[model samples]
Target: MGPLYCALISQIAIILAFAIIGAGLKYIDDAFDEDRFSKKKAISIAPIIVLIWICLSLFDSVSATILFSILFAVLLTGKIDNLIFKVSTIALISILFLTQMLNLLWIPLVFLTLMGVADEKGNDYVDNHATLKLVEFLFSYRFCMKMGLLSLCILTLLPWLYLLAFLAHDGAYESVRMLGKISVAHQRKKKHTIAISPTVNE
Candidate 1:
């Protein structure tokens, strides 16, 4: 009935939406060949991701939160194995990078580069490369979001942790939960990728 309640509900819905899509992604990747998702499966999941994006659009003004969520959805669509979706995601990121945040261009650039490494597994050099850079950047971004949320929480405090105050804290970083998370492919193939990636004579 109130703003805090509304925020709490919206954030919960957002988390559930991401989690559901993430789980669906697991199945999609596992049950089929790489880059192959059925139209039925895609049909079921697309609306959920789209709905979350819409909700996030209305809920938060934080650029990182919105961008990351859309990025995640784009990643999921790629798993759908549709070239169109992949191209659309690329176009979306390019538009964002070139047009929206000049200062933040490096963020998406690095993000896309790191993502490319997963596909570059066969190449000895790329596979041998450590994920320290990507992980480090992710941790840095996570830290920034944490600080942003903390400051928002402190500034918007309402009489010792009322509903509004708690919601305010949660509200600041919409993408907070996704920070430092493993993509579906990385989670599924980490073992093989890591072990064979370093070998020169494979």
Candidate 2:
């Protein structure tokens, strides 16, 4: 293939990898949250996921790398409570420091991280308290980050393609979450059936 074609393929590969890794991270979190797996298992797998995510971010351009690193750090620190996640995030932050990835784009980082935090908090609130359909729908899918990224793109602060990649990551994360919910429901149904089957037979 020509160099252009090769470069296109490489970009596609990176986006796909991000999607898969994002899904894996969500799966582990969902497993723990839904009681499908032990906290120990989630903790054990978190470091590997964090490491891979950091390594992949390095492959992007410097601007994208800094954005990804800052956003990732913000989300991890602001939302996650697990000890392993906190430790991994600290390590990730240290990597950013050592590599000089932390730059003077603090304003944008603050804006994006605030959007991320809003999404996280809004999602939780909507899940338990929100009654309006539109409100629930927006937060349920975590649209805050999407909007923030789009704003940045419109302002020429970030490339448009990064928004698409972020969508891919969010899409994969939601898909895994939905599948996990279904699996948990199915397991509950199966156990209920099994428990009553013997009485029905008797």
Candidate 3:
């Protein structure tokens, strides 16, 4: 209906694209054996994908930021395997987190969070700092802009909301992978014990 609404749709389009790509990467990894195609590595490229997206952001900030957030969420969810950590991290970032664009600055928080990433922490920090910048508009703007601000926050939080759903999903794939390892170990032990008991029966 207007430029603002058009911008909203464009950002949504980018967000959907990242979601589809994230899903496609997972499916591809699942289709192959772990040795042939590591799902970890597949999702690991999420940062690179996002870095490239950020480069494209210069041309379209709104759309680029929205899409990057979605992919970053997918990447973040892939790395962290704790519910309480994710929940607590989200709460803190929603309230206490801060970021800068020109310099890419954030507080030194070592807690496991989506806000950062490093070799030691694995997910130390995200390249995008504008994650919550639009929060001001939602509360500080005039009545005329209330609808627009509401729409922006909803769009901005979509990636985060999606990650929450993924984390709460019916047993994450990592858990299933761990179970598979345990099952193999259990079967091997059972067979070994049976083989040893026959020799002792004599």
- Give each model a TM-score: 0.37, 0.83, 0.28
Q: Among these predicted structures, which one has the highest TM-score? A: 2
> Which is the better candidate, 1 or 2, if ranked by TM-score?
2
lDDT of 2 by residue, 86-118 (tens): 677677677777877644366666677778778
RMSD of each: 12.0, 2.9, 14.6
Whichever of 1 and 2 has more lDDT, that candidate is 2
68-166, model 1: which lDDT tens digit per residue?
533553364344355434544565556455545444334433443344333332232333655566654444333333333344346652122222322
- What is the lDDT, from 0 to 100, of the residue 47 in candidate 3? 46
**For candidate 3, lDDT tens digit of each residue in 1-202?**
9999987776555555444444433333342443334455545644454444444444543333433343344455464343432443353234222432322111111111232222213223222234344543322222222232234346563234333322322123344445546665787899999999979998
Best candidate (score: lDDT): 2
Stretches > 4 Å off in candidate 3: 32-202
Residue 113 miss distance in model 1 (angstroms)? 8.9
lDDT of each structure?
0.43, 0.71, 0.39
Best-to-worst lDDT order = 2, 1, 3
Superposed by TM-score, candidate 2 places the C-alpha of residue 60 at a distance from the truth, in angstroms, of 1.7
**Residue pairs clashing, model 1:** none
